[model samples]
Target: MKSQNIRLCFNNTVKALFISALLLFNTNLFAEDLEVTGNITQLGNDWLVVQGYTFYVDQNTELRGPNGSIVQFSFYQLNDLVQVKGNNRGDGTYLATRVKLEDVPNNSNEIELTGYVSAKGTNSFDINGTTFLVDANTIFRGRRGNPFSFDMIQVGMLLEVKALLQTNGDFLATRVKAEDDNHQHGNEVEVTGLIESKSTNSIIIGQWEFFVNSQTVILDRNNLLIGFSQLNVGDRVEVKAFKQLDNTFLAVRIKLEDNPQSQIEIKARIENIIGNDITV
Candidate 1:
């Protein structure tokens, strides 16, 4: 009887251990890999919020910048665009393995364009004639620096955009800020781009309409005086204007420019060299 009792106890113990191991294996099998890109809405010592999802970071988490340079957790800031790769925990949270900053700072490789939004799509918008694509990593802010999203964008709204030029000629918007023209009193706005349309008293560049008054000065590439009628569509120009009380941009000066050369540099290993032609 004593031996039978001991045997029964051991078997029960072994069964409980097997069940526990199975449960652990099942929990791990149900954990899903997760990858998300968005602005960091919140930051804490060991956690971050992106796109309304919380991700916990630990010592093993890898932090990096846009250039893939290793960074510290402290390097992240609220409103900074980031991409998080991790696995979802069963408890409605995620364990991040890597966090990467996605924003490219305003530099020579980037361009700033401010104008009225002429068009908008599901994931992109047009300002001044350039189409800017926005992804989960795009940061949108109001004039007062409050966080916003792409859904706030609408046609005819004045916006300031900072974007990087993509290899395929698309402008990938990194930041978009809503501007209130009413507060722009005496503030000068400048736009440099090809003229998209022209009228007897106004001209449109990209999508920005600038009114030309009798006081408006028009000059050629050489700074020589020119008439308003001399301007035409497709002409490259730099316009200095100010927001009028009625919210219209009134041109103070317009200068024509020679079409600038568009050049792009590519970095890749040369696969083959054949007399003035290289394959990469």
Candidate 2:
């Protein structure tokens, strides 16, 4: 009987040790540092959300700007690109130790785009072949400031978006405002061709001359935002403009085309396919 008690005590001690080790392992796992890079979606007195993850900030947290200069948390704005180093709290949130602001590339642009939704995804939407990513801080509104949600958006719906281009070539939308489909702008014109000539304020495509202004959004062949000064003569482009009361076409958006033809639809029966070649 004494030997039985000793065996029981030994088993109990082993069980306790196993449980202790497991708890330690889990603690270390949760203590691991995590790094996240994305645009700041939401900001609060002591917390910020990035890419749908909430991170708590405290006095110990270090905040730095793009130039590596110390900065205050208040300097950050919604949709500002950032990199965060933190520890997961095991409750779906994080405790940030470092928050650094990232600079927008020179090729990037802050643009206001108005168009029909061409595609939709869980966290993003496409307009005119350009993808716009959305996060918690992206404000959505209907006519007259009525509340709207991302789920309420649909393909073919007209929306006006204000967005910033990220270094990774994604457009992070800051605001999405729905517009009426029937609403039309007067004297809207769209032209596609090589740039015949260009000046400080205008570009010639075919026979139409489109005037560019500070508000004009220029994108490169990769659909990345650029400046009007980056445009060169003989480059292929597509220009969307509106005629002003002064009988001048004001370019609203200018996109560089990747190919001579934007799209080509071929309708033919496939006869055979070999390796990397297909005969139709």
Candidate 3:
């Protein structure tokens, strides 16, 4: 009789175990299911790479993962998700999505650009044979293509760019980076030279070219005061600028460098002073 009782108990235990296993399998399936349409790849330690940039999709953001799991990503790891907004980096990484914490602003509206004054004057900056105007109210917040324009820009120049498009489909920039007292603090800067170029924009000591956007600027008097006509080929200068979408600049004020000074002579004659003198 005791053996028969033991057999009956074993059968009941087996049935309970089978029921427990079924419930656990269902739980796992619910946890790992994906809802969004993308691949799951490791970005870093504390982050996940969803579209292109590094983002942590926790309970804060509306983004979700397969199986309703939250995804977060990191920034300090190699092969990390790049923090760029667009797609294609020329190195086989093409993120077909645009990811951002917030929407990009219309930086094309009212810009400020600062770069070395060109021989064409702040009024006319020619690059690759294309002419662009520089003046007051030009924008400089980089929302356009390419981080920095070609190396044609210099230092110790003033550029104040506007956001208004001209009739010719170009932006109208007012000159503001030069001797303008309003922008006195942004005129001067200390920069090192790139590899072998004599141009003024700072770069690393031995590198062929330095990224211009990462360079520094000094805002002080006597840093950007040189007549545009006095500038020669391969002159080094500092600039305070406002940016446009096309990476153009409008000078606010300008100053010539005193180093390796050039001789600038001015001739003036006093004509007959014709003025209504008020005698007290």
TM-score (all chains, Cα) for each model? 0.31, 0.34, 0.23
Which has the greatest lDDT? 2
Residue range 1-280, candidate 2, lDDT tens digits? 3454322122222222110111112122222234556778899988998756688988988899979889998989898888787754424466787898877543225555566576689999987566899999999999777878999987656688878778796889999989864332324455677787889899986557888765466777765567888999887787766566576777767878766642222222244546544333
lDDT value, candidate 2, whole model: 0.67
**Order of models, best TM-score first:** 2, 1, 3
Model 3: per-residue Cα lDDT over 186-247, one tens digit each:
11122221122424543222212222332223222344324444444444443333322243
As for candidate 2, its clashing pairs are none
- Estimate, for each residue in 137-184, the C-alpha lDDT of model 1 and write its tens digit: 898999787767898886656677877767786879998888774322
Relative to the true structure, how large is the alpha-carbon lDDT of every model?
Answer: 0.66, 0.67, 0.30
**Could you say which candidate leads in TM-score?**
2
TM value for model 1? 0.31
Name the runs in model 3 displaced over 4 angstroms: 1-110, 121-123, 126-131, 134-155, 174-280
Model 1 RMSD vs true structure: 28.4
Better of 1 and 2 by lDDT: 2
Sum up the clashes in candidate 3. 77
